[model samples]
Target: MTTADLHTLTGAYALHALPEDERREFERHLGDCEACTQEVRELSATAARLGLAVAETPPRELRERVLREITTVRQEPPAHGRRGRTVTTGRTGRWSGYALAACIAAAAAFGGVAVWQNQVAQDARQEANQATRQNEQLAQVLSAPDAKTTSGELTGGARGTVVVSQDRNQAVFLASGMERPPSGKVYQLWFNDEGTMRSAGLMNPAASDDAVLLDGPVDRATGMGITVEPAGGSAEPTSDPVALMDFPTA
Candidate 1:
């Protein structure tokens, strides 16, 4: 499914309002789309805070219906499983709102506590999956051949560790232990490949020295450098490299 399709169904899925056909379809979409699943879970949490909400009277009987339906569909949180490994996505859902409304109106509803709880567990799982993916990505980028562990320093009144992965596919420069520019000055990263320079990003003197792993689209060249440039940085280096790191050929 397209990203737009997943976004369209996110609200329905999180609120547990999707019809049977839609639920099955979305599940298939989620299996392949990590980004969508994460988006849905975060939205679910926001919705949950309003579950026991008074901003609006729920449509009535939504809580019970959602519980009964999700009961058979969702698995309960494993009490014996790793602690905090799982979490309830959120308490508020499409059916949940409907159920809550009904409950408030003194209407009788199917009293299924077990099913209602399962939805909570599913939410927890969604959040766990997101965190796991980020951790894995961090490890992956760090393993790149160009990954460098430098004794952080600054030069020409500029400071930062230059990291250009072995393949020149990823890079990151974190700065610390340096003085700020004399107003209107900034630090920039540029990737020089085949005599062409592309601006990577700007530097903030306050940036920490942590091993900040940056996202991709880095220089395809074997060489990398940091320069003192404009606030937003330029495509080409206006000055010499205060710091330089290179990626080796595989």
Candidate 2:
């Protein structure tokens, strides 16, 4: 085989998918070709990482499908060597067919695992970016020289604090020792602008200690409040205030 053709087979060889005759020929080439040897090693390591990334259960019919294909397929005779004689398979042909089938199944499974791992990594990256944005928003509020903090107790034995920026255009709310809301209900935050109440955001009830960056136009709000509302929250206060704290305008 030409060196180029042998080079193309490096991946198949690394995956153990090459036929025995071709495998032996490739091994001979490996002895004198340092580049091919390094290529094969790197490909083999990549395949190993693909396999270990995720545990996959092969399809139940994989073996049956392989055996079925083998029954209908014909094997090619080995290439003639320098002595001009074809290599004889003898009784090993049957085992070699099964080995080829297993290799194919393994390769397919690894391909699926690599895709799954890629998606998992992408999701983790998105979550990290979201966290970074939240932190940046909170830092803006905390570092402002005109920042003010106020604390209050809620109806359900929960306590919370609100940190408002100088311009009151941004704020952060932190809650602790809060009980999980009853089913079909959620904790909702509101900004009291004059006598009008506007929705800020919803809170996760299960968290014992939670922090959220409040949506803005907060400078217009004279105070902030929390209430238990329906799952999706309400446009206006659906229940009396569970907690209320005034924002220092001065």
Q: Pick the candidate with the highest TM-score.
A: 2
Off by over 4 Å in 1: 1-139, 143-153, 156-168, 208-216, 248-250
lDDT for each candidate structure: 0.49, 0.60
TM-score of each: 0.37, 0.52
Give one digit per residue, the lDDT tens place, for model 2 in 94-184.
2234655675578677776566446645543443344345544666676567878888786667788777886648887777667756655
Question: Candidate 2 regions off by >4 Å?
Answer: 1-114
CA shift at 209, candidate 1, in angstroms? 3.0
Assess candidate 1 and give its lDDT.
Answer: 0.49
Task: Report the alpha-carbon TM-score of model 2 versus the true structure.
Answer: 0.52
Q: Which candidate is the best by lDDT?
A: 2
